[model samples]
Target: MASSDTKDISYEDLKALLGKSENLFLVDVRSKEEVDKGQIQGSVHIPVDTVEAAFAMAPEQFKAKYGVTKPLLEAPELVFHCQMGKRGAAATTKACELGYVNARNYTGGYKEWSEKGGK
Candidate 1:
């Protein structure tokens, strides 16, 4: 597990991280309607309301449902984002409480991502 003193990740850091590795796991913790409009490429949708239960599921079940591997507790980059920043921060807290110490909230969220030219 990578140790990060900060719980929040800025858009610049996120963009750089995405550029550097495919190992990063991006979770979109937005509403279904919000997600239907668009989302960060390669991100898996897990609405904020279901974050706790979703993280509690077995890896196989999570993969089956989300069509992506469930992030391991020790993974270096387990990032969450919402339409804005609030829900992502909340979801990051939930993940940390569930033992995902490396979890981080993308503080700028989707709005910033889009405005900043993120794919």
Candidate 2:
């Protein structure tokens, strides 16, 4: 069984963090087609298949490609989400393996965000 110790942030917690943290990076790992329909506002779309490569890029390159500052390895609010949860969790784990020890998964994901009236 997978560890229940994986770091996850809930919708309410994420909302609070969003209001307070200018450093937060909300990364959406869903497909482009799924993302074209709707997404949590302010999320950076980085498809799940490209997550590792994206994370490996230099800071300047990442910013050029994604149009946001590259989050440092220790960034406190580096959060990932998908249409649902699985991909986000996987991305979080991948980030942790890459030294992003503070990485987090928004396990509630975009579905819950939309359902909860997140904009």
Candidate 3:
């Protein structure tokens, strides 16, 4: 599991991941309805609610639905986001507790992303 105060990336670094195809996993921990408003171009949506419900319910379903091919990575750097970072931080904490070695919370979140003119 990752440390609670582990290193975290800036929004610019987050954008660079998408552009450079870094081995980072961007997880949008927002709901479907909120996602309908807007989202990062290639984020994988895994609602905080769903995670709270059960992290092990149909891993294949999440992968297939999200089109991610990576194996269940316990060590990948997972960047989590929500509307304003609150939920994302919770999800990040949970991810770390569940053995994700590198879990991050984007505090700026979608709201800040949009404020910065990101689509």
Question: Which is the leading candidate under TM-score?
Answer: 2
- State the lDDT of candidate 3 residue by residue for 1-119, as single tens digits: 35676345678878777787657778898889999988998788888977643454466765666678432546455788998888888887786677666778888899888889766
| Alpha-carbon shift of residue 100 in model 3 (angstroms) | 0.3
Tens digit of lDDT per residue, candidate 1, span 22-85? 7799999999999998889888999999999999999999989998889888889999999889
Q: Candidate 2, which segments miss by more than 4 Å at Cα?
A: 1-5
Over the full model, what C-alpha lDDT does candidate 1 score relative to the true structure?
Answer: 0.90
Model 1 residue runs over 4 Å out of place are 1-6
- Window of ten residues with lowest summed lDDT in model 2: 1-10
Total backbone collisions, model 3: 0
Each model's lDDT comes to 0.90, 0.90, 0.75
Q: In model 1, what are the clashing residue pairs, if there are any?
A: none
RMSD of each: 2.7, 2.5, 2.5
TM-score against truth, every candidate: 0.92, 0.94, 0.81
Worst 10 residues of 3 by lDDT: 69-78
- As for model 3, its CA RMSD to the true structure in angstroms is 2.5
